[model samples]
Structure formats: structure tokens, C-alpha cells
Target: MERWQRGDGRLIVATNAFGLGIDAPDVRVESGRGGRDGERSEAIVVMPAGRQEELQKKIARAKARTQPWKIQSRVMRPWETKQVEWEKMERFLSGSRCRRIYLDSEMDDRQDRKRCEVGEERCDVCEKDDAMVEDGEARRAAYVEEQRVIQEQAAQAERERQGPWVDSGIDVPSSSRNIPVPSSEVLVPGSVIVTSPQPFTDQDITSSEEEGRPIPQSQCSSVSFDQGFAADHDPVGESRMFEAQKQQRSQQRWRVEADSQREGHEVWNLETRLDSW
Candidate 1:
């Protein structure tokens, strides 16, 4: 045993002779017929299926030797210990309860009760009916697909809204609508061109010269200025009528302020007269 513990011998083979008095902490693995230290370890026992009858006969013989005789006492002690050890090994291999709990109970440790109190870390039998593992995986898959669909829909909407601009082959600036274009050329369909009635082309200039009629500059200038101002201030106070209306509103505001001041002065005069009385 000392030689095995010191690594001088890697293996030890004996028939029930090397079971006791061996306390090597570094001995991690043991393969034999029974349990060793009451710590976390694995024990593998290989026995023939036909040996059940032989094991039963041995147990019966050991029970019969329990009679109170001087030699029987000596023989019964080993048999009782072996019987108890065999029964514990049988329970360990039964697979009905948690292996850790069974091992702790067999070794008379109270740690099994602590494990029961927590009730989280359980054996295969306890976790066999758990459905959350599958349900969580399904929910994660559905969420991923939902996010993918939302992203696809947003991308499709963006593509549809920008389709016209892309098809026209023009790098449309954000301020394109405010840019002035030539009257002869149309940049977009359905756009209304509010040009002057008398076109200012070279043909019109030659026709006016030949007809000996000069174009009225004042009327043309006023119309062009009004059109440009209307474009700048569309939908709010852009007409000549709106300018007159704004003037009237300013006069009304002045009248209201003067009336309020006059009433305040009258109240002050009345308060002075009451104090004198």
C-alpha cells in the first residue's frame, strides 16, 4: 500500500485482503466489488447475473451462523459487515432516487436534508417533467423571427418611398423644391408654371418692335414681384388684400390700447375725488 501510495506501483490486485487500513487521499479512482471512502467517487462492480443464487445462499449461511458459540461469533462479524455492505451497494444501483442523496444517506451524512430543502438541484428523475427548457427555446426563436420581419418591413417601406427619386436618375437635394427652374423646362410632372401672360422671349421682343408697341414695364414688374412674393410667403398674408387687412388690424390694436389707458385714467380720477370727499 505504501508503494502504491508513493507511485512506485501503479496497480494493486487482491481478493478482499486490501479492503481496509488503506487511507490514501490521492487515490481518486477505485474499481472493485464494493464502496470505499464516503466521499464523492465512482465505484464499478462487475458480477455475473447467475450469481444471485450463490449470493442468496451466502447470506442464508451467514444468518445461520449468528448462534451464540465461541467460534460462531468470530465468523458472524465479517458476514454481518459484508451483508450490510452488499445491501447498500444494491440500493446505490437501484436508480429510483437521486444518486447523491442515496450516497449521502448511506454514509449517514446530513447534507441530503440540505439538498432537499433547496429543491433546485435535482436528479434526472426530478427534471424529467420540466417543459420550460423547450418553451424558452421556442420563444427565443419566435422573437428573432419577429425582429427580422420588422426590419424587413422598414427596409421595404424606405425603398418604396424613394423609388420615384431613384428612377428619375437625379440626385434630388433636400432643398430641391425651393430651387427656381426655367419656364421652358419642366423638372417634375403636374407642376403649375405661373409665367407672365406676355412671354419675354426673343420672338416677342421682335414682334413688339415690328408692331411699334412698347411693352408696359410697370404692369409687368408688379406682376412678377407679386408672383415672387407669393411663392416666398405662400399660405399666409401673401396677397395685396392681406397687406391692407394687416394695416386695419394694426389700427384696431392701437385703438384697444388707447381705450384701456383712458379707462385707467378715469378710475384714477374717481379714486382721487372719493379721497377728497
Candidate 2:
């Protein structure tokens, strides 16, 4: 145990790694001393686990010696102590005066004191009650005003759609009968150019001029065999390529089937070996 002075008060703190079993009477000072800020924040006092472990071991050894002894045991388990500490922390944080009053009524064990209120030693919250209530009311009023603005905007949009002129020529029917397009328009293959009013190539000769290919004097009609090769026949060396591709595909399928069967057998053997082990 070591003593230090802070806030003009002497604070005795335990750093001895174990409880010294000190029995000071009239302990006006709080236990867990470096804990003034921590008390306000509801944090735990972090004592090392060395002493707690030793205490548990000693208790276990004693219990082992008296295995058949018949006496009722009374001990505060860790969970019970934690619950008491948590309850104390919750009461300390609660903001309502009514809640604090109820807590005070429940835990005031000393009959010497009538109540926990201090005219001369007030807790921090007792001095600031009025401001908290005012802030809460202000926030509620602002929320109600924001909701009113959204409702007004929605109503205005509904009225605009109900007005007249929903049938005039300017209104434009939703059906295709009101839409206008020239009858000559039609889709032609290999080019997006419009061919209705005149031949599409009449509009431009620059593409042909750049390529230096004379536009074949408009052949009124003949399937141009020179344009592309016939699909049924292959040229010279290309005829044998198809046979090689077919053989390769057949070999790949055989390898895949054999590997799958080998994997299945290995899995079955592994399961059987594990069962024997």
C-alpha cells in the first residue's frame, strides 16, 4: 500500500499486488482511490488476478479436506459481487430525480442519516436539474415543426396533377397513334443509313473514295460469290484441321472420366481407414 496527496486530500492506494488486510476505522476516504474520474465513468477498478487466484486455490484445498462435512456454505461468488457493483453504477448514472430518490430510499442503510441529499454536500446533478428539463422540451418542439414542412410539400404535388388541359393537342396522347414518322423509313442489313428517299450510297462517296474501291456498277441482281467463301467447302490444308480438333476433344473427355473415378475410390478408402483406426 502507498499513500499519495491529490486534490488537497490524502489518497491511499494499493499497489502491493495483494490485499494487505488493512482495517482502518472511519474510512471517510473511498476505496479504489485513483478512481474519482473512473467512478464518474462507471469503469472497473483493475486489481491484478494474483491474489484472487491464490485465494481460490486455498479455498479449493480446504473444500477437498472436508469433502463429507455437513454444513451450509455462504459465500459471495464473483457474479454476485459483479451484480452489486453494476447496480451501484447504474444508480450513479441515472438522470431522473425520482429515480435517484427511489435508489436512495432502497440503499440508505445508515439510520443516522435521514436522506442522502446534502444542503452542504450536494452531488453534482442535484445542482443542475432545471437546465436538463428545458433542453429536453426544446428538442421535442423542433421535431414537430420539421414534420409539418414535409406534409405541406406532399399536398402541393397532388393538386398540380388534378388541373385541366390533360386532353389538349399540346398534352400529347400516351398512345402511338399520336406519334408521327415517315412511311418510307425501313431497316436495311449491313448499314444503318436511311434508304427510303433514295439509295443510301447517294448521300456519300467519301468512304469508297478513301478505300480506292470502285463501287461495282449497280448490279441489278446476282449472288456475288467473290464476297465470301461458301460454308460447305474448306480450302486445301484447312480440310484436315477439323479431324485433329475432334480427336483432341475425345481424348480430353476420357482423361476427365478416369480422374473422377480415381478420386471417388480414394475418398472411400480414406473413410474406411479412419473407421478402422
Candidate 3:
């Protein structure tokens, strides 16, 4: 493992299900499945490495057994058929041409038909003769710089998209209008400008209740998003709404009901808040 860290030992021999979402940046030896998330990685198969033949025989017998080593049919992602993807895998490991070209041919997944280019991610076979690691490094540096510039441009666009800062339009009284607008049309950062909704005054509340009309843009009773947080004025918060003659009609009704009542009359209140004898 430490040899792998020193950029020497990158030959991983085991084949397992460990490449679904692996994010490691170092080289890996997968089962012909290079980095799925497009991170730079590699895969290798050692033909008759110094290991003994007895180890191979044990693994082969394990594969042929009826125990848990048996290969189960896995569900295909694109379809319901059980597709064994080992044929392409075998071709990629044994082929002598560019590793990328083999993958592109087998997968047929390239946007445009092009071979492995210099300075991009390349395999051991392509870089064996040239040995130009500097090209790949420079390409990565350019990619990082381009992404940073694009990110800054996107941020500027978002700020421009926000446009101008409009006032809440809920009237602020003359006393608290002390904070003047900033010099720049856009709001300056770190400037704490506090505002509140317009409140109903004592005279306004009294007049609204007596006139039997809704308080003009009450800032608490009801919320009106259209006028920027307009609230219905509710004095005393009793939620009382008197009809044009609801009070007069109630008084007259009780008077009629008590036309010839006794000295002590049992009073009952109706749903309309009218008293009856």
C-alpha cells in the first residue's frame, strides 16, 4: 500500500464490486471498468505473474461450486435481461491498442469518434513511448483555471439577474426614515437598514371602528402579499364585524320577545348574539 502511495505499486489484482461510486484519485485496477465518474484511473491484468498455480486452481473451483461463490443473475439497468458484460472486459484487458479506443469502440459512447488525445487522461500503453507526464499536468491546470473563470462569470450573472433593490412599499413613517439610500443603486454589503410595516394610528383606529369600515391596510389582522405585507387593522382583536343594522335588529327583536314578560325573565342568547325572553 505504501509503495502505491509512492507512485510505484499500482497493480491491484482483485476483482470485486467496489467501483460503483468510488471517488479515490489514485490509479485503480478494476475489472475493465475504469473510473465511472470520469476521475483519472487505470486497470491492469497480470498474465502468469510469479504466483503459484495452486492459488488459481482454488479460485476456479470456488467459482464452479454450488455454494455462495456461484455467480447470481443481476438485473440489467437498461433492460430486464441478465447481461454478462465480461466479453468487452476481456477484450479491453488483452488488446494492444489505445485503452480509450477499445472502450469507446465496445461502449459506442463517444459524442464524436476520436482517439485518445495528448494531455488528456491516457493509459500506460499510450504514454509508454512518449513519457510526457507534464502535458497531462498542464491540461489539468488549464481545466481548473477555466472552471474558476466560469464560476465567477456565473456569480456576476446572478447578481445582475437580481437587478435593482426595490423598497418594500409598506409605508414607513417620517420619524424612522432616517437611513438614507446608499450611494450605489445596488445595496452596499454590511449596511444594516431596518424597516417595518406602517401601523394604524389612534385616530385612524377610532375612526375606522366608528365608521364601520375596514381599517385601511391594517398591518396585523390579515396579510395581503399583493401590497407588500398589508395587514387588516383589528383594534382590540375581538374580530367583531357589525352589519349595517345587526345591532339595531337584535335590540328590536329582544324588545318584541319581551313584550309582556314577568318580573323575573329567563334570558337566552341566540347564535346571532340576540337576547330572548
Backbone atom clashes (below 3 Å) for every candidate: 0, 0, 3
What local lDDT does model 3 show for residue 68? 61
Best by TM-score: 1
Alpha-carbon TM-score of each model against the true structure: 0.28, 0.26, 0.23
TM-score of 2: 0.26
> How would you order the candidates by lDDT, starting with the best?
1, 3, 2
Winner by lDDT between candidate 3 and candidate 1? 1
lDDT of 2 by residue, 108-206 (tens): 543343333553333345546545777888998888888887788776774465333322312322332322344455667977666433333753567
On residues 23-100, what C-alpha lDDT tens digit does candidate 1 reach at each position? 666554334212444444455556677564565565567568966746546555877899778776654454434555
In terms of lDDT, the poorest run of 10 residues in model 3 is 162-171
lDDT of 3 by residue, 1-277 (tens): 4565576875544436545555556544353456666665544456665342444454456458885644455645644332335434444554344677766665657645344686566566676634656677889999999999999999889657533322132334333244333342344468865444556789988998999997675433333434354345454332232332355457657877776463224332242356333
Task: Kindly report which residue stretches of model 3 are placed more than 4 angstroms away from their true locations once superposed.
Answer: 1-14, 21-42, 49-84, 105-108, 111-114, 127-277
> Scored by CA lDDT, what does every candidate get?
0.58, 0.49, 0.54
How far residue 65's Cα lies from its native spot in candidate 2, in Å, is 15
* Best of the two (1, 2) by lDDT: 1
Best prediction by lDDT:
1
